[model samples]
Target: MKISDSFKSAIVEAICLLYILLFVYASVSKIIDFENFQVQLGQSPLLSAFAVPVSLGIPILELIIAFILLFPKFRYIGLMSSFGLMVMFTAYIFIMLYFSPFIPCSCGGILEKMSWNMHLVFNILLLMMAVCALLFFDKKSFFLRTKQFTVRLLLCTMISSVLIIILIFTFSEKIIHNENPFLRRYPPHPAEFSNAVRLKFNSYYLSGFADGRIYLGNYTTPAQIISFNSNLKDRKVHKIIFDPANTRFKVISWYVKGNYFYLLDGSIHKIFRGDIKTWKIDTELKDFPFFTRAIPIDSTTLVFRTNKGKKMTNTIGKFTNEQQVKVKYFEGLLQAQNEGVFDTDGVLMYSEELNKIVYLYYYRNGFVVADKNGKVENRGNTIDTIKHVNLKVSVLKNGTEYAISSPSITVNSSSTVYKNILFVRSQVKGRLENDQLWEKSFIIDVYDFRKNIYLYSFPIYHSSPAKKFSSFLATRTHIYALLGSDLVVYEIKNDLKKEMNSK
Candidate 1:
């Protein structure tokens, strides 16, 4: 039997209508993979020059138009939007195919879920549907009243698109610039800072110079003393400075600590004790963590943070059997909740008068404490435990006080040492030229939360032409400094070895 004319018309309309639904589904798929879609749009040769704004806005418009197209009443308005969008896509695909970068189906899971050949065929079929609507559907949809509405919607979308482009240009850089704020002073020259052991009653200072050199100074007469250096043999060091306050706080969280200097590598600790004239490597602790800062709470307990993503603690011991180095850790205590480590990656806050410190790590890990025993216990893990000292009070914030734990409770995965953070603000008066001659006047500030006060900031000017600067601070009274790879006595005296010899 021959098919009726009305039935044939209905069949054609149904097939054409499926394209509208498919278009809507595709638009939603793109929106779901919005990030990847934007990435693709930006890379697409069609809009690469003006890619950013288009990448951000086009998917929304496409989805809106696709939905409107499904209804016969608003079909004209939908066609207007689809026409503009399709023109852009056609241009994009042709350019990509011509130049031939060979895109491997980056349109998201939905588009890729269809086979590659099928995707191409489906796009062509959709284009044909749009054409058929333009030809036949245009007959009914193109009445004067409907045409007027469609034109107005297109005009508004074009105007809005231009405005979004302008806004993106005006403000996007500021957002990106904030992330790289330290591009100027960041990435100090590289120098090896490991294997630092404590030197008894010596004074040492280690600093990285604006010039490709490290400065090591030893003060003896309260300020004046001998100095030395260590030649790093041309390696890139990120940044360098003396321990912020010349104390145990230099090795915060997971840093290397000893009687001499503290060395904090990415995740390695090297504790050393030697004079600057004669170099020596003492104790090297690897893989523990290259902590940002660490301070000794007492003879037994230590607190610190990994230079990485976590804050940890390590408990000290008196050696039960003279075999294993006994230790425990508090994982995830100080969840770097402030400025998120970017603004203050290697910065510290130390207070002297309060005998306390509020150490801040990069990311959001920071701790506030009035004394050395400020720690937070997670689950069954005990953050801090004092031997002779009684548990007085452990406060989380200024308003609330909570108890941490009793003596000798079980702890795991905590760091015994944290990182030693350093913040140096360099101010120059005149125009700064190329980095070769660029000079930096260093002012250092540290926060010791155990003391609860911001300590003094000191200035470091170009002193002697440093041959090599490698020094470690054991304490305020003792220091081990290196000059040109040679060890020296860092004290307010004549010479360290000579004093030992003369005595």
Candidate 2:
């Protein structure tokens, strides 16, 4: 069928409107949840600094591009603007692909309806429309207008775009925010401590923020379990684990569950609530500076020990604890025999599934697993009769017996996190379900004692290909891997969905 000029113009206009709608929705959603966006940015060496400025500006730019394109006189100008914006976006993607290993979900709300690849394609399509609009040029051309009028209009357009860009840079964070978030509270309170620490095989890290509140996230799932209120000093979070032995809750590293949280700053263990906002001073210790392990055996009991974690911020002094809340520690392996040898800073794992704490130490022999009860079970040993592979271990369940999962990989040297970039060293290959070294990207290796075979792996990286250094999160049903601004979700295999077993 032959289409008329009017009909064609209307169709083109509708298409243009849809693109702008997407842009506006995408930009605005991210603006509303800018802090989450910042975390994503921080995960990348290049994006964090760009986050504040971009967060405020992108939405406004979209609004402008949308409004201008709708105007009959400014149709071509709108098209040109869209083209420029798309170019900027495409460039951002390529840059992220190379410099950053993970990506974040910058698009939220309405725009999230489309996939990332589709989002890119849509932007490119808009660029084409902008170009097409240029071809449809008819009204009094800018060149044909009086020189004075032409100059003024041109000047006005440039000024408008410039102002918009500047606003994006200046108020990007504020405009998106309905309220001032930074001035508000952070680091949740610690109330009770679960008598357990956990090992997170994957990147689903549940850590405490400085505000005595819990801070947790993963790339695969949604609904983060975190709450924050009060300053860092007033927090108490630490826990002690047991191997079929019950221990009292004392000043330890950290604890997580519900209605309870204990934190150990360098000097003392602060006890607070996961459900409440206030905190109380738990008993202070003598060798507080040297204290490391703190595990809660019951509601009012705990066992305290000393083990330094990775970052200074990771100190129990810095983290507020809660019941069943997942936590991780660097735990440079030490010995009960030696009072203090060179502390071995090991893998950073989290409390997941069941309050089991699993950590990978680069042992002179191999690695070991620290169960919820502080029992270090050797996963691999440099000494014979141990597992040598540096596998990713996950804390599965809790109770008399615990469930743990590990996905091993071969890596070279130490992992690196440069600027905002994360470079981990791991080598494991497998497909999504089918086993093919050639086809698998990120390995999701599952170890089922029920199956009697100890091999399972899958790639859980999002935004980019699954690699070391990329951050991730796990939910009941899915896993979300964050690669910079990209948030990729992975649903568990049907067979492994609810088939958790004890080791």
- Best candidate, TM-score: 2
lDDT of 1 by residue, 75-183 (tens): 7557655655654454344444554323323467566676545555666666565544543444454566454554565566545644544454334333222221111
Tens digits of lDDT, candidate 2, 85-144: 766665555444444323444445654686656766766676566555554444454346
Look at candidate 2 and tell me the lDDT of residue 79. Answer: 60
Task: Point out the worst 10-residue segment of candidate 2 by lDDT.
Answer: 185-194
Task: Report the alpha-carbon TM-score of model 2 versus the true structure.
Answer: 0.31
The stretch of ten residues in a row with the least summed lDDT in candidate 1 is: 378-387
TM-score for each prediction?
Answer: 0.30, 0.31
| Candidate 2 deviant stretches above 4 angstroms | 1-8, 113-115, 139-141, 144-503
Alpha-carbon lDDT, every model = 0.37, 0.40
Residue-pair clashes, model 2: 120
